[model samples]
Target: MKNIRNFCIIAHIDHGKSTLADRLLDYTGSVTEREKQNQLLDSMDLERERGITIKSHAIQMDYIYKGEEYVLNLIDTPGHVDFSYEVSRSIAACEGALLIVDAAQSIQAQTISNLYLALENDLEIIPVLNKVDLPSANPEEVTDDIVELLGCNPEDVIHASGKTGFGVDKILEAVIERIPAPKGDPDGPLQALIFDSVYNTFRGIETYFRVFNGEIKKGQKIKFVATDKEYFADEVGTLKLTQVAKKSVKTGDVGYLITGIKTAKEVKVGDTITDFERPTTNIVEGFEDVKPMVFAGIYPVDTEDYEELRNSMEKLQLNDASLVFFPESSAALGFGFRCGFLGMLHMEIIQERLEREFDMTVITTVPNVSYNAYTNKNPDTPFIVNNPSDLPDPSTVNRVEEPYIKATIITKADFVGNVMSLCIEKRGMILNQTYLTPERVELTFDMPLAEIVFDFYDRLKTVSKGYASFDYHPIGMKTSKLVRLDILLNAQTVDALSALIHADNAQNIGKKMCEKLKELIPRQQFDIPIQAAIGAKIISRETIKALRKDVTAKCYGGDISRKRKLLEKQKKGKKRMRQVGNVEIPQQAFMAVLKLND
Candidate 1:
């Protein structure tokens, strides 16, 4: 236990954190030849599909250095900005961090941001230059930059290509040397930080924590500081990188222990676990409650799949603490849930999972930021609205404030004019600009978070010819003249299609939205009036003309089976739509309107 080192791996997206984790498990022989896998830390299908780490994963390894076996606990963290909260939780669980920086990309905005989080936690950091095998790799320059930024000796930086297994042994050596051994009173009462949790089918809820102090054993009653619930531990086990090995873990060991508690509701992430027999007086601060930044409606394509959707969401929530959902009902779509997420990527991943994993198609509404509304008459009362339809009356909402972000764009100097122009068009104000290099420039802008919620980044790439990059942090709330624009198909609110837009852009934005809706939604059997409006007055309207004859004229009784098959096909087509009075609107129609640049 004296030689045990517990640490986490942190880096920006695509910085090879998962790849490096795989190499570490391999070098330590934690994963054998038959069990070797790609991107070992990315265990979820969604993570693999999106090529991003969405959850924090841990693996324990025993590395023999100089004929001495040392237990190494490596926690792999998500690199995306949306999941930074999870990164913070994982960082809190470990005593040290291995900050991986890409050799070619040098230090990116996210890399710097996450590095600061690690430093703020006062965790020991061993800077590493990854992707050393790339043709354009500049390990020496990156090493120098890291030294200047992190205040570390350039010579102390570890150079390695996680893909090629180069210098992996050296990284292990550095972890053992630089990362401090876990220091806690092994004889004292148990105290641990609940960094992560997962719902187990057999064991109920399995909480993963690092024993910072004292020893823990099976059958001991424990107390979670956050929940104040006491439960007897059924088992204590360690991850052998691939499979759970049943063993008695002690202080400084990174492992998952099972209790009788069965659901995520019982074992909350960021809770502290302690011995109930002799409770400690000191209380460690739990992680801040993360609020979902983006909200959207999610419903099953088939109304009957509602139960499956709920179960699937519960299963996902077991591992992902970031996903939040509540019951929601739609007139056309039936029962579903209003799911909240950290960002657009997080929302998309959940929707895709419903289709792929659960075999249930989902109709999602436009994503919107949470808003606080104040009525002039009731100045003391504040109303929170997540759905645009739930917004207080336009006249009643005297003042509305939406979240804003300080956005930074790093791109070639040649595209500065184009980038600035687009920013202004999106109602973004330029804050600052600096040149990282003669050809590379960084532009800072104060932008409304709603403007870039959808395909704004894609448009930026188009304007900058794929040479531009974007990063942003919330700069707090700002007053805006925003209004909810509801789409009505013959006098009924199409719950699947609602958007919040700046009052100034309402008419034009509504027109573009109607056009996109017309393109994505199939024409119904009867003519449907697609209109977008603020309150009762309609500003933009488009007609989805009724289908002249979607069905064949033959076979009422003759060839009945063939006729039935044809009708089934036509029904399949109509199933793609959310039928409101005389109109069937496809799900894509809702998403298309959200990106209507027309």
Candidate 2:
């Protein structure tokens, strides 16, 4: 334990955290020259393509300094706000963190959010200025910003270039000298914190954990404190990019436990694992389950793929516990699953993976934030509705509360006005503003999650010229004048196109939705009427005119009575078709409203 140092790297997206992890692995000889690759810690192809880390990874490295051998356990975490929970779990298992900041970009919204998470975990933070080799690098300014934000000594900041492998050794030396060794009682009853887990077909559920007390060995019976399920350990090992088998893992050690448990549901992230027979009396603290904030319905393009989609989702959920889903049926789209996600990016990633990984084409409805709806007769029992179609009647609803987030945006001073205008336009209430530097400013607002979940990020990027960064966290529910807007096609309500919207913007939203639907829905034999309504009152309407057939074109030089009879017959047929015709709404039509804010 005295020679072990557990630390993780935290940074904003595209801040070179993965690059630094690669450099450390190269310097420690964990991966040979033949095996080294860019972003070595990022295993997913999507992660490499996007140049971002999506999953947190842990590896063990051995290094010798000053004739003393030290074992370093390094965990690389995702920098996006969507995976902030993964960062928190990584921080809980580490004693220190290397806070990486881009030298050119300096501090960002996610950088500050990650710093707060590290501080909350009471981890020793080592600020590192990365990418100093860039022509636009401003290490001095970044160093000062770090000092001001952390209130640390100016000399404590370390400068490193992840691109050039400069200052890489110095970072390892700092980790050894500054980060304390893990503390635990080796003889006490077994207690381990399961920070992460993966499902293996051959070995079943392989759990990654940090032992707080006692030891875990092969063939030992262990139980999860949360589930109270007992399983015999089939294997014990540490990760060195891949699993390395070991006879036992002692206290204060990070390793994987291969249990015969066949499903990932049995071993949850943040759950406590302890000895089954001689179980510890107290479970480890700070175990909170991840709850998804965004919800959307994903349906297969082909109705017959419903069972296949469910199986694919189940397989994916084994690897991602944060993904929540249940069966849902749509009147227009057929059977599907109403899935919950951490955020927009998470939802997108899941959809992409479902298509690319599972080879299934699926249509995703407009994403929604969970809302609390209270009926007049049951005001005390406010029910949660994730789908607008599930909401009760507007006349019966006494009030509606939507989830709000405390949003933080960092941008150049010149773009502050644009950012503020965009926020206010989204119904955000300004909380406060502070100038981080003479040229940079930070703005805080209490914004509805629904307003920003769709297109606010893209708008902010466009308005700020891609120089602004944003981060948000849930701050609870806020009561507002909210109403469910329904789209009607040929006088029939389409449940999939329904949405919860603010009452003030209902008219405009209804108009835009009707226009978009008219553009997307194809013309039929009869005019297809598209209407947007609030309750029973129609607020906006548009019609897709039927294609003209030139009924009189064939009657060249014919009698006027013949043309008249043809016209009357055509009109009668049109009337009959309008009574029995069903408007065939394409999948794109159901998704057209999502682009309204865009």
lDDT of each: 0.82, 0.90
Summarize candidate 1's per-residue lDDT along 192-215 as a digit string, tens digits. Answer: 888888766776777788887776
Instruction: Estimate the TM-score for candidate 1.
Output: 0.90
lDDT of 2 by residue, 282-345 (tens): 7877547787889999999999999999878877876676789999999988999999998888
Q: Quote the lDDT for 201 in model 1.
A: 72
**Lowest-sum lDDT 10-residue window in model 2:** 259-268
Off-target runs (Cα >4 Å) in candidate 1 are: 243-247, 304-308, 465-467, 549-581
Alpha-carbon deviation at 182 in model 2, angstroms: 0.7
Clash pairs for candidate 2: none
Using lDDT as the measure, which candidate wins? 2
